[model samples]
Target chain A: MRIFTAVVAIAAGILILGGYFFPAFEGMQALLLNWAVILAGAAALVGIFNLVSVHTDKIRRQEKGSVYSALLLISLVATFLFAMILRPNHATMKIVLSGIIIPVEASLMGLLTISLLYAAVRLLRRRADLTSIIFLVTAALLILGSATLPFGNMPVLGTFVGPWITQVLALGGARGILIGVALGTLTTGLRVLFGADRPYGGN
Target chain B: MIELTIILVSAALLFGITLWKRKSPANLREIPALTRLHRTLGLSIEDGTRLHISLGTGSLLDARGGSALAGLAMLRHIAERTSVSDKPSVASAGDPTLGLLTQDTLQAGYQAAGVEELYVPTSGRVTGLSPFGYAAGAMNISQNENVSANIIIGHFGPEAALLTEASDRDNVTMIGASDELSGQSVLFASTQDSLIGEELFATGAYLGAGASHVASLTVQDILRWLVILALLGGAAVKLVGMI
Candidate 1:
């Protein structure tokens, strides 16, 4: 099983690398990435199956938190029926998802950010680490500068310290992180392929 | 042609450096944060404390990244450790594919540890519908599992607090990280050094004894340095333009 998975992984890697060099093979490369998406699509069943099995078992056994499990089962089935079978138009799905999921998420987002901000302020006042201070100051300036538009009249002033600067900094940081991530991804992938790190049936 | 050559050459250089490190006889360095995680894993099981872990919603098939892989590696570790201790390790998922991969992985972990008899599907659930649903499900697990140790490593969004809050209430030792936007909750709560963005990619390679993962870390380090240089150069050019 490990060997088979490794061979498949190697094939996928080669197709990707080959496509980078040979434009003629770009179509195949595109197909490989597409295969990744398809794999993700197919994997969805794994989670659903898990939910069903767990919740159904809980319901059968009448576990303490079985109510939550039962609710999960009902929600999953309802979602599937509403989204897949009904093929509810975008507006209807949007309303349903937003009405239920969005508000809860939004509340969490707001609460988490606000609480963290308060803690950060206290942290800045207390420990005052150089890095933390820098991060805090930059974030504060960004927020303040953007919210107030302090340099409204002077376009140059605004341009120098405004969204553009933030954009450049954000992009640079993002790019650096991306490079690091890409390398990290390649390395781990190779390990799984080589059977050096077998989380699957390979070892 | 040039770009491809550049990428291949850089990749090769990185691969070489990583291989060199593997050949070295240095003992694996223990990260302080990871040590805490290890301690938490052991303690949870020893005391009948449940451990709650999430592999995020995205599966290996759905979203391919180091974060997803790291989440999986951590899950395997949690499962094996928890199983040996005869403690329940509950896992939750937002992405069904990942949920399945998680179950299989946990089952494998238990099998590897010779504790397959302890494997329970109810312990690892796929309950969340969306990102929020996933968080809610995780929160539920934190409460239900009476989680003693909460270790979350994956691609998570702003909804991180839900689970963290539950852990906090339970007074569980929590360690987590997200590859995407680092949640304020995780930042505030977790003692484990959460890897932001690309740092997450190095996790599996760093933890696993493999050539590819090590090489990837080395290359990633080199690339990071290059990026730093570029940023400095870019800043200098911008300063000059301003002048």
Candidate 2:
């Protein structure tokens, strides 16, 4: 069974890749891709069920955050039912997305900024390496450069330093990281295709 | 034609190296994060505290699936280490499809260890589909579940900071890795030991998954050097043209 699954996966992968390069296999690729999508959707439903079951278990056991679990269940069920009944683009759906979800996410973003600043401050305390010092200095300069001065933009800090640091140094580093990730992804995909790493389960 | 040649060459090198390493296993360079992972797993079992592994918001059907699979491989190693312990490692994923895969990996690990009965469906969970929502769920687990160690190796964005911060608050031993650049930056600062760039993909190899993983890492290193040389050559050519 494992061998059969691995063979199917490799064949599907090859077909998908072939479809990208060859016009003849496009239909087959689409069919396989659609099947994968349907499977993903079904898996998502199962995940939702798993979430409900876990929370229900917590609620039943009256764990520390049982009330939170109950609240989460109520919210999930209510939102799911509303989506089914009113459809996704309804005013209520819009309100839920804009009013609740967006705000919460925005707040998390705000928290992230503060947390980053806090991490910067503690970098020295944690590691105290030359790298940490350089990171802190760079961060401090970037923050100062980006901050609005009382007499308007400081040309040296804001215009020259900020742009050079952000557009040149940071961008270069990010690009390097991206290149490495791409190579890693390619290697991982190859491993999967060759049946060496069976993430789809069997091995 | 060039792309296909490169792909075929890489595949050949990867397979050839893998077969060679099966006879004589290649020694991998030390990854401090992986070393810390070994200690963290031992600590979790000794302390009877849970180890939370977040697979991030990578879906199985998308580009992020590669990272998600890498994360799953790490989870399998973790599960094997904790299979006999009362506090087995728990995994969470942002995508439902990946979460299902995580459960399978967890079960496979336990079964390999001859402890299949200990596998629980709830051990692997889908926290949230959205990035922040997933981060929030993972943070809650890290904070409330007596998680002694938190290892996040998956595809994440800037939201990873939230998860790292949660672990920080509790003084949990945190090792963060991600394929996303923004996530790499965030985790580099926040995580005590961060796996940057391709190091995230090398976790399984570093943890002794198999010769194939090691071979893949060797191929990655060779490719990286080639990329560096190409960059330099291109720069030189551009400089000569300008002159």
lDDT of each: 0.66, 0.88
Clashing pairs in 1: A40-B61, A40-B62, A43-B97, A47-B96, A187-B212, B57-B95
Model 1 residue B82 CA deviation (Å) reads 2.9
Considering summed lDDT, which 10 consecutive residues are worst modelled in model 1 chain B?
A: B184-193
- TM-score of A-chain in each prediction? 0.69, 0.93
Q: Give me the candidate number with maximum TM-score.
A: 2
Tens-digit lDDT string for candidate 2 (A78-171): 9999999999999999999999999999999999999988887777788888877878888888888888879877778888998999999999
Docking class of 2: medium
Candidate 1 segments whose C-alpha is farther than 4 A from its true place: A30-39, A78-86, A90-95, A110-175, A193-195, A198-200, B10-23, B27-31, B59-64, B182-193, B205-215, B226-243
Error in Å for residue A184 of model 2: 0.6
| TM-score of the A chain in model 1 | 0.69
Q: Pick the candidate with the highest lDDT.
A: 2
Per-model TM-score on C-alpha atoms: 0.79, 0.96
B32-60 per-residue lDDT for model 2 (tens digits): 88899888888889989999999999887
Q: Compared with the true structure, what per-residue lDDT tens digits does model 1 show for residues B98-198?
A: 67667778897788788788787667677675877788778877776566777777777666766665666677776766666455234433333444555
